[model samples]
Target: MSEENTPPLPGYEGMPLAMLRHRIRSLGEEDLHRLMAYEREHAARTGVLEVLTARLDAVRQGAEPSEGDQGFQPEAAPPPAGGSPVGPASAAPASNPPPHGDPAQPARPKGDHRPGGGTRGGR
Candidate 1:
């Protein structure tokens, strides 16, 4: 479709399905038709088509355009104006395992120091 035939809502193509549904409430029947046509000609997504079709049907059955501007999308607000607050001072200390096996169970010394100090075969 030509640029003139674009969907009435700004950033319509990029809008999430939920956002599109809410935003389309402010559109009249004519605007919804344009949007539905544009959507069918382009993406033709199932969910988007369902939303448009349902809204169009509602409008045809005397559902008036809802209050508030379609362009007023508070959900699409700009990102906060600064880097993350994380810093070295706020970070947790590094962790290192004990050099001698596990801390819970220390490694045994060199040779076996058995009770009677006898060799394997009772030598």
Candidate 2:
């Protein structure tokens, strides 16, 4: 499809399924059709198609567009300017391994060998 027929929503192609569902609620049937057509002509994703079809069906059944600006996507908002707040001071102390092998199975005594020289007792 040409640019003229692009989906009504800006950044439509990049929208995740959940975001699309929320964004499309504010759109009318005509705009939904346009988006559905664009989706079918391009990606034709099954999940997207299902969402579009379900919404269209709802619209055709007299469901009005929900309140909210389609362009106002909080989910797509950029992360905070500063990087992570975690610092060395807030980090957990490093752990050291046990000196006597794993905690689950403690190391045997120096002369605790079995008769057959096996490490496990009898069995």
Candidate 3:
């Protein structure tokens, strides 16, 4: 199919295959059919086709799609019990080094020489 004639698949771009499969679980028959058609015409990936086919079959067997699946939730870390967040006064952090090349190399001082001559011919 031509790029210009492709249908819009809202909320699917850049989504992982597992996430896409889960996201489409709630799609009705008509919508699922549309998605299947789109997949067949464009990517035709076997794994994707299998997932869509399985979901469609499940729907046909009267399995109602569940609400959004909450995959993972991370717990927040606790702060230190009593000590202050700041480090001790005597300890100092080193300055950030310049990017690129070796850090051990000495820094180069800026010079007055200009390359390709200044705007007024190589004066």
Identify the leading candidate in terms of TM-score. 1
Put down candidate 1 lDDT per residue, 1-123, tens digits, no spaces: 675577789888789998888899999988888888888888889999999999999999999998997666788779899998899989999998688766998777446456666545555
User: lDDT for model 1, on a 0 to 1 scale?
Assistant: 0.84
Q: What's the TM-score of every candidate structure?
A: 0.61, 0.59, 0.47
Off by over 4 Å in 3: 1-9, 67-123
**How displaced is residue 89 in candidate 1, in Å?**
15
**Candidates in order: C-alpha RMSD to true structure:** 5.1, 5.9, 12.9
TM-score of 2: 0.59
Return the clash pairs for model 3, or none.
none
Model 1 residue runs over 4 Å out of place are: 1-3, 83-123
Over 8-118, each residue of candidate 3 has an lDDT whose tens digit, in order, gives 345454556877776777676766777788888767888888988998898989978666433331222457699776777756777886787788886674465456555
| Candidates by lDDT, descending order | 2, 1, 3
- In candidate 3, where is summed lDDT lowest over 10 consecutive residues? 68-77
Global CA lDDT computed for model 2 = 0.84
